[model samples]
Target chain A: MGKIFDFQFMIEIIPSILKGIPFTIMIAVVGFAVGIVIGLFGALFKIYKVPVLNKLTGLYVSFVRGTPLVVQILLIYYAFPILIKLINFKFGTKIDISWIPAVVFMFIAYSLNAGAYLTESIRASILAVDKGQMEAAESVGMTMWQAMIRIVLPQAAKISLPVFANFFIGLLKDTSLAFTAAVPEIMGQAKIQAGRASRFFEAYIDAALIYWGLCIILERIVAFIEKRNKESA
Target chain B: MSNVMIEMNNIHKKFGNNHVLKGVDLTVNEGETVALLGSSGSGKSTLLRCINLLETPDAGDVRINDYSFTASKINKHVKLEARRRTAMVFQNFGLFANKTALENVTEALITVRKKSKSEAIEIGRKYLDKVGLLEQANQYPSTLSGGQKQRVAISRALALDPKIILFDEPTSALDPELVGEVQRVIRKVAEEKVTMLIVTHEMDFARDVADKVAFMSEGQIIETATPSEFFTNPKNERTQKFLERYLQRFSYSI
Candidate 1:
């Protein structure tokens, strides 16, 4: 809709951007999966106040959340290999790092970002579950871990579903930063197409529309799942 | 002598500066129904929770059936084994909100007891039926009435076949009309001679179901007596006063 934006050029590059959609989606999904594992451990440590690790988790979450996502992407992309090398050098280990994909680095960075935000969500949701639920499970002879996994986490998950959905949507948009790493996600495709045509605004608009459409589709699927879950629950 | 099912000796618990259970002791024999009565803040619930090590008493000796350990010396396996020997029915029902009534009843049976799913379901059904909730087994806790939820919880407890069942003010959270239904289920359980230790404000239910009623005040058991003798002829002045204050409105009902 902006002046000097060529509608024709936007339509032409939309196909190119569409090709990058899979990369965008793949990273988001992989990031989300990795993020859940990190978030659960971080949240549990924070909840239990597990000595020194809890303090470290607090600092990790604060640092990740306080900084910009793009900075994290660039910092991890450039600096992680150096840190890995230092660890290998000191430990006398020959962990091969060269074979890792560029997108794997994106996965690591984005997951850490998503994990920090999700740690808070998971902690709040777990706390929000009724105390009695844990007691009831333990009362019936469950170990604490069994009670948490069986009784408490399910209820907590239901409470945190909306937050999870919002985070996933946010993660999709955050995938735009992956373009900085030369990962051919939606925004990466747009950047390449716009650079070729020298028409940045139109390509970005096309990419934006695709993201909007994907989000809408994701939201619909979530709504439908929620409805089915409600019926069963 | 009858088998001793649960024994708490010199149990001591503190919440920072607040001392809730102060060197308290009680014994529940097999097939005994001991009703614990106390005014609020008397530490009756805390004492019940100590039986399962739910509160992790600062100091005490707990012996639940074959597992015995000083509270401070307990390891995870002994603690869990002792817990496995007893089940608690909480005042708020405490039904797993995510599980159906049947699942709640079968959870420990399948997971802790290592029973087959079909076997657990069959056992779960029997207990659900015992509580007159066989039809509601598929329903979630949120959908059931408070009475139904508590009944499902009772079935859950019964399904474990625990050495003892601990009730922490089981009917206190129910609506007045709903109280009778759960009380009926508990009464039925008591009639079967299942070992039980219940904390309750219901003086009449205590008198009706408990073989002995123990009075607790300020983190100590003041006097324990047979239901008839305790209700009609309380020997302790503190207990007499507590009963007088708590029973004023229900004086004629008592």
Candidate 2:
């Protein structure tokens, strides 16, 4: 307890945690890409108020947004498989549905969580585009969907870029939750290393530093994109 | 007889209880230019927007050449077909902020009209040249001056080669110094015999560019005549009063 600081131990654990960086980045990229697709269609449904789907998507976003993401990960990874087993049992069908990868479950959980927040961000950005833009697009014979995809969405993308970038970096950090599902991302690797060495503080500090460095690099990328958008606009 | 380019009958529109437009009828012969002259809240813009189905009228039937659309039961196919024949230029320019001037002009052609990209670019360049904005084709709307933005909007509208064009106070949002450039473009389009319906506050521009002028007050067109007669000898007392007030502001007397 007297010797609290351990610089040498921290330096030693850095390489072990660094090995998890690629997995962490991959989970974030795949999860966020899936989220962008889900979020775009979800937002469009809500924005256009498409019958029952709109209400259903609203409930989904509200439920996901209302719950903690960690709980969602547990529910999706653990409870979802049980639910599927129950359905198969009730139907009396021999379906080999248990072969799905743990990584897939982690991806689903992260994407659903990110998508809920993205729905609101993307919807608001689309709304922020001037209503006249839609009118102008339609006047030139663009259908509602065409106008949205081409005119409204392109402009909305610019408005929502900064928010999206922030969410992306946040989602990257959130990949640590993948450890709960045994996905072996950054936190998973760090936790194992700390447990083996009994140097939890040192290992955790290295993990934090890695996250900080990655986030700083990502922020620069976001700034470069924002600058390019501004210049072209 | 000249073929009818546009016909709107008994158009009725209300924003809740505001009653912006009520039972308005307008016809535009092919190649005719009509200017809608009215003060704010007079529903000139609403009337123009109804033709494109931007603001669906509460009750009306609109015919643009072969396509017909009824407000009560809007047929999306017919509405789209009708809208394809018309273009609109907004007071705020309404150029796509994310697109370059050339892209703004070419987007609809490539997407809705399904022209090949090369063909769309060729047409877009032609219109940009026509508007004298060829040099600025690669520039985005935010970087352009107001006059340049409006000109680009005009180029975008013109590139579609619509049968009719609607301008809702195109120059009203421009600086005084910039208005002349847009007006000159409009004058050139008029000379090309494009059917246009413009809602404007610039009385002199209206007189100079409109083949016919219609004066509206309280959601009704009180008078329609040749621009010369409408400006110098309006029939309705309301038209006279409105023009007098407008002209007086500019230190001109009828």
Candidate 3:
């Protein structure tokens, strides 16, 4: 049997796929915002070599990086409640986390995964700052934290900007993985439409087109920021 | 009255197997400028860094004005206290590249000195003017010339109003043409009677700007005397040999 290509079917499913764009955007924005926060502390712990926190961060980054993100999402979505219930039973305390959405759990998993990657980028950026910068600040009686915040990190942030922008685009694409947890993001909506109409090719193509459009839009925003930063310098 | 601005006693430092400093004793009196004359790897920079606890000594004591810390153990409190009284001008002109010339001068004031924004800016401008970089105050280090950046670094150190200022070969990184401008700014600072410890290779500048000159060799201060006496009548054989070598290479007569 010859395979059939239907441009009309793809066009028809475009609006349905576009409807999931908001959720995709939400996951990307929230995951990245929270990921960067975690990444910064993870970076600082490693940079400063804080006693126990350093080792913990190292283990955490390794685990997240070594495991597939989909596995992490599945674990958080399916097993997280059982783990929490186990804690509640062990401590003889009634605790509930059922109110939270599966999408929330998916975001948490994605945040942690992104954070592990960002940790390396931020740590390298922080390292890329001149050693004499810290020494100069310290010579003027600024503490390490003060020196880092006031002198080093600003420069480091500039160095990490492009890397952060790339991660944001990557995160936007990765939100498609939220479909595995039935979060109704772009891929999830497309899968449902495809299942209903038995038009997998057209529905999936529609989803890919939407994601591609979003990424291109994001690239322009990143380019705008980089251009602005360069002009200011 | 205690006129001593910095007193480093038996300072010792080691980096791995390299014993960079060994029982190096140094003192800088208030309103005095002392130049540390030494060959490279003679522990001159290490000695200067120890005074500010930037390179914590393996052993000994450092006193900056009234604050003192024994280097036998961790004493962040005393180190910070001493650090507040001293600022170092790095050989590399370590002005924060991200900050403008004025911000470089104002950063420590607002954060460490707890000065108001207007007051800090006012003080920053005064020092920038002193270094003759007021016109370039808004410029970042990357855009400034080596001499201008060093001048900004000097202004930053000076603006802190520390009891003592340490200059770690401040003009060493500049081009020969740029060197004079930075040296002139340093000479102006010397005239201000701020206790200064300068580690320098420029014998002429040292003799002109330093009231006292101390020579170091093999991690020890081999000779210390008034600039006139040290240059005219060298005491140690090592000091005489060093001066001869330095003079012959630089083609300068004492």
Candidate 4:
């Protein structure tokens, strides 16, 4: 074999991959932030079973979770422009579809997928807060909602942090799919550079290394939070 | 003539096929401490919970300070008025694990009474100090001992300045040594002339502190008397048997 590894090849792609880091981090951060909100609301809806809204949230979670992230990215990218046109027709006005819309669509897809899993995790942790604690709050003449907000949710968040952190890391990795919509995130930029230079193997390896580094950093943060929670508990 | 603080008239509660409280009637006068002594599943806890509307009674009326809470004939406004005057402390220390001891105590004062944070904190600090936990004000419940947590729960109830406090076996979860600390805090509150309805098995504490004692058996009050009267000369055979069983089981001669 010529060379098992090529240091020069790896070194050449470093600057190009570094250039895409901001985009990669942006997609991950935005996707996780949006997903957390959706997950919290979705979990609350399922917990309370708020009539029609509950059923709709359940359907959204199942639909998003049942399909693959790759398929969702492709569908959101392709359907977004057409959906905007239909909305324009109904409203009797034109609406432009742009990069922001694509990013938003990709964010929604990733977040909702993360949210479905988080909903279950959050709901379970909320239940684990103990029934006696609730009874005690009520005995003190607190209304149901007040007790849930002041007493229950804070404790539940402590329990939910680990699972939430795991979902965030997974969401970060899934940002690779944003490349399909020409979002030009790290993976997409690496692929474009590799195509131009005919160095596909080198480029993909760089992408893998970048992803591995991010996951390691995220894992340490999650571990630290979990340790703190345990010490407090 | 003692002014009636709380009156339960023919209160009944049923859970599916289980008849928990069968027309249980009890009353406590203003500044009176009534100990509801009973074996497990005798509807003692259920009666206390019903007074605060934590568990709604199926039939009969609970009147606190002349405000009837029975939903049968009274309007919604009347029921809401009565619930405001009562508060409960649970068997397990129901301190909010997330909040500091001071925050948990002041929450109701801020939310319900519309007291400012500074004012609520002042009131909360007084009650916490009364319970001997003012130093632990900033500590969360998860860090406290069983007795300290229960004391915080007591302070939370007292911060509302409720007319009546219901204690549902407040010291049941405490270590044997810690039980006395909680009992002393409760005893101090009793001395302040706060009307209380206590469901407990702490016979000596109940005997020493209670103005009246009501013994319940199979969802009914089988005996009601002053502590001396009940312990010395129990009227009903059921009360006699209960005293005998406990006195023998714990090997304590009364």
Candidate 5:
């Protein structure tokens, strides 16, 4: 009771927690990268009002946005085995569940979630671009798709730069949720260390510091990019 | 028979309940510069937009050179064909904000015309030089003056070598002092025998540069004639009132 905090214990466990860094970064980087692609098509479908895809994208976006991240992770994680079983039982196929990795589940869940939010961000950004840009491109003989790729998207990407940075940071920290699926990300490693040593406060502090460090480094890199972008523009 | 560079027949456009262009018929021959004059809400801009299919008309036929299509039946192929033959300079410059002046001029050349980078850049530079914007080639639209931006836009249009160039209130958004620079470039383009249709509020500029001045009222072209006859001996009563209203500001006498 006399010693309020354990600095030495926090230092001792930093290395173990650091081991989870790659998993956290991999999940977040891959999730966000794929999410951008999903979001782009989702936004385009909605913008162009593509018949069936637009409605499906809207339902997907709403489903993801309406639910919590932890719930989504668990739902998708549990749903997969059941889905695979249904497929195997219904069809004459040997679709083994062991082949799929747990990390893949987190990737799918996080990406779908990120994609929903990014769809709105990307859509608003695309809409925010001046109407004249498209007109000018079309006036010069570019088809709609050509104008979109050459003219509209670059400006929209620039407008959504800060949003991308913010969302990526959110995603990086959100990777801690991977613990629910027993994937042993940063928070999972922290929990293991705490249970082993019975020093919950120290282990948690170590995890928090690691997250803060990663966020600071990434924020600096994004700041540098934003500055360079401003100078060029 | 004058070789028609552009022929728009019975163009009708409606914005919700407001009918903007009502059965408008217009023709532009090769090497002709026609300036469209009208007060606000008179649909001059909408008429110009229909040529390139920017704003689709509710009903009409737009023929740009050999590429013509019925407005209601416009498909991707026909739209591109008509659009490729015509270019527009907007009131807002419409320069790609993300692109440098040179890239803006060369982008369509590389993408639409399938020109090589070196060739596109060369063509881009020549047009930029024509508009006197060659020195600002690397500068973005955000950094350039509005006049310079419009000059870049004009050069971008010129680089395409379209059958006709449509300018929608090009100088309307420029500063009072800057308007002269854009006007000068346009005057020079007119001298080069480029077929152009310019929508403008400047009666003096229209008179000075136009081969013919056409006055629009409500949603229709009420009068069209040579600048000399149109300005000096107007036939329509509405044209008399319209000119008097504009000329009154500067106490300009016809």
Candidate 6:
């Protein structure tokens, strides 16, 4: 308790944690952006039931959603190396993978998790759009795909924005899991500093505070978007 | 004149166990306004939907302009061409809620016809002005009242400039006072020589604007005639019973 307010210790560690902010932000932004792509494809596949692809997409979504995200991150970072090696033997080429591989793996895992949820949200919103709208678009010389893209998706997107934003913030928090891959994100750096200086309590507290602050800001932004959407609607 | 702008041959549709349209046949000449009148579930709306391929007929041929669309035998190209020439307006004003009224009107022009944005907007504004919704051009669907939304929907259909426009109970969703505004818009379009197929309950509007009226019942068109003949001297007993029942329900003089 007496060591909790070690001002000099906190001052020294602040810069180290701040240095990791870029990685933290990168994981969140990239993961979420990729997640949206996955979500859009997942949604399209599920809604249209495109031959064999729809079943494959369902399998992927179910697998991703059924597994815990933390286990997924670990398997992607660790077990994936052995899988790649096996594939490399089959292809007869030694594949040169980099740290980028780990980042991409993390992105895939987080994106897929968010995508499963987003797909459900998008599908529901799309179903809620009146069926007459589709008939009207079709009658006006627009093909089925044209009606989906130009008419149905736009209205469905407005309905889905709030849920999408919430998923984005969840993806941000999930970035902390990337540290297991030795990615040196904010949480990783804080843990490293705490280990070296024997200040685990102080370092972890600061990390939790930063995460809470980010969540608050994201919530505000989501609220603003929802309000604007309602007013426009 | 072309033999027919639209020809429906033995159209039949069923939903689950219920028969909606049963062995119905109809035809519309070029530049004609045909009103389909019936009690609910009497197949008026289902017939209109079938004509546009919105509701696939369980059995029938829907010939529009030069293309023939049959639910069982339609090829992709035939379906495409049939859809391209026909336009429909719905009872609930199915405007895309996210887009401005003008954008909703212009979406097909740009997406399907490959018109430039500026060109589509120009065409959109023309049709919107035609429907008397020019002032509401930039407004979203949520901003408009029921009648205004229907007007915008009318403009959207008109923007395609299709060979014919089908209205499925166009004024049914509007307020009692607001129904006349949408009806007037439809009347104005009809006066401009636009070919139309309307399913409606507005007996007065049907009488005044329709070149022909088809009365449907129990999944069949029981009778069809010029509005005066249909109203004053309906031949089918079912048609007379329906008109009498409708007049009684609405408490209006027929």
| Candidate that would win on TM-score | 5
Residues B1-254, candidate 1, lDDT per residue (tens digit)?
99999888999999999999988989999999999999899999999988887878999898887878897787778668878899999999989898999999999999999999999999999999999999998999889999999999898898899999999999999999999999888899998989999999998899999998999999999899999999889999998898787678777757
Largest lDDT belongs to which candidate?
Answer: 5
Alpha carbon deviation, residue A41, candidate 4 (Å): 2.3
Q: What is the DockQ of the complex in model 1?
A: 0.82
Candidate 4 at residue A104, lDDT? Answer: 73
Better of 2 and 3 by DockQ: 3
iRMS values in order, in angstroms?
Answer: 0.8, 0.9, 0.8, 2.0, 0.7, 1.4
Superposed model 4: Cα runs more than 4 Å off: A1-6, A98-101, A224-233, B72-83, B250-254
Candidate 6 clashes between residue pairs 3 or more apart in a chain or in different chains: none
Q: Tens-digit lDDT track for model 3 on B1-254?
A: 54989888898899999999999888888999999998999999988888888888999887787877789864777667878998889999898988889999999999999999999999999999999999998888889999999999999998999999899988888899999999998999889888899999999999999999999999999899999999889999999999888778877633
Give the residue spans of candidate 3 off by over 4 A: A1-3, A87-98, B252-254
**TM-score (0 to 1) of chain B for each candidate:** 0.97, 0.97, 0.96, 0.95, 0.97, 0.95
Clashes of each: 0, 0, 0, 0, 0, 0
On the 0 to 100 scale, the lDDT of residue B46 in model 4 is: 86
Q: Over 4 Å off in model 1, which ranges?
A: A1-5, A80-100, B251-254
lDDT of 5 by residue, B56-159 (tens): 89998988888778977988787789888988999999999989999999999999999999999999999999999899999999999999999999999999
> lDDT (CA) for every model shown?
0.91, 0.89, 0.89, 0.83, 0.93, 0.83
Candidate 2, residues A68-187: lDDT per residue as tens digits? 888999999887778778988999866665677788888888888888889989999999999989888888899988988888998898899999999999999999888888877788
Give the runs in model 6 whose Cα sits over 4 Å from its true position. Answer: A1-4, A96-101, A227-233, B1-3, B250-254
lDDT of 4 by residue, B3-96 (tens): 8898889988899989999988898999999999999999998888788777777899878976766736554344346557888888887777
Q: Candidate 1: which pairs clash?
A: none
